[model samples]
Target: MPKILLLFAHPRYEQSRTNHALLRGVGELAEVTFHDLYEAYPEFDIDVAYEKKLLLEHDVIVWHHPFYWYSCPPLLKQWIDVVLEFNWAYGPKGNALADKTCLQVITTGGGSEVYCSAGRNNYSINTFLRPFEQTARLCGMRYLPPYAVTGTHKLTDEELRQHADEYHRILISLRENASVADLKDCEFQDDIPPQLTIS
Candidate 1:
């Protein structure tokens, strides 16, 4: 199984029922190293060397967070700025992260209907995630579609549990390299075929 590094960033994680349930689903997975950015760097002082080391050790990197104003939280942005350096992650000599996989797991308060061309947001979730996709490309990582749990403000406990179960199954599929093909053409990892994710 490939080692998976899940970089989780949520400033107010304590208050988010969605994130809490998601974590509970996959927190004990043996192949996943769950790194909570907010917990580690409360002062916003990121250790670039340590962060790079973590990246080097993992085959798949997961950027898990809430959709904050169409992007990630401030600390995750800062981590991107400092950890992925010129001579390390992008430029000619920056081949350390080449051939790795990048996945995003996100939650949104808005419903899926509100994220389309004719909706309130006026753009798809994929359109809003272009920057993250480009970042993974620049680092030579294969970026997969995100796994999104939308309509979070009104999701029932049962709905939340189902999403959480699906998340756990998705992680297992990724770890075992069992469903990469199914994930490639999906707009969201949530669209992955149920059969492909059988654990």
Candidate 2:
């Protein structure tokens, strides 16, 4: 079983309906360490050593956040910049994160339809997440297609619960060391078939 380090970041978590529910769903799951970046470093001061240690300790790293301005919140970006150093995360000698897995769990305010070449956003969610994909690539990590919850503004409580249930199942699958090889070619895990049906 892979130990998942779920790093969540949201500036205004209290006001978020979808993200709040998603967080609650996985808060007590075993073998998944839920670390809230904003709650841990409200002042934006990240502990580089500790963060790197965390990276080394976990088999899977999950960056959970709301899609802010088509990307992640500032603190997660800062953590990447500061903790993933040149020689440690991505240099000729850096192999700490090699062979590990990375997953992004994001909530977007816009509907899924709005994030496409023909849509108002003019790009897909994966297109917008290229930087994150490249980061994993550079670190020799297998960047899995993201698990997204779109249309946040329109999702009802039950709809949100359904998505949250799926999120929990994804985490559990990862924890149980499920093979995600077939899912590598996918753009979004949410779009994959045979969706989890929880009553």
Top-lDDT structure, candidate number: 1
- Model 2, 72-189: lDDT tens digits are 9999999999988887888989888988888898999999999878999998888888899889879988787788889899998999888877788778878887766533433354
TM-score, model 2 to reference: 0.91
Highest TM-score: which candidate? 1
Worst 10-residue stretch by lDDT in candidate 2? 190-199
What's the alpha carbon RMSD for model 1? 3.7
Tens digits of per-residue lDDT, candidate 1, 1-199, equal: 7889999999999898999998894768988999999999999999898999999999999999999999999999999999989879999899888888888889999999999889999988888888998898899887777889998999999999988888887788788886556444433644322332312
Candidate 2 ranges with C-alpha deviation above 4 Å: 181-199
* Candidate 2 residue-wise lDDT at 134: 88
Residue pairs in clash, model 2: none
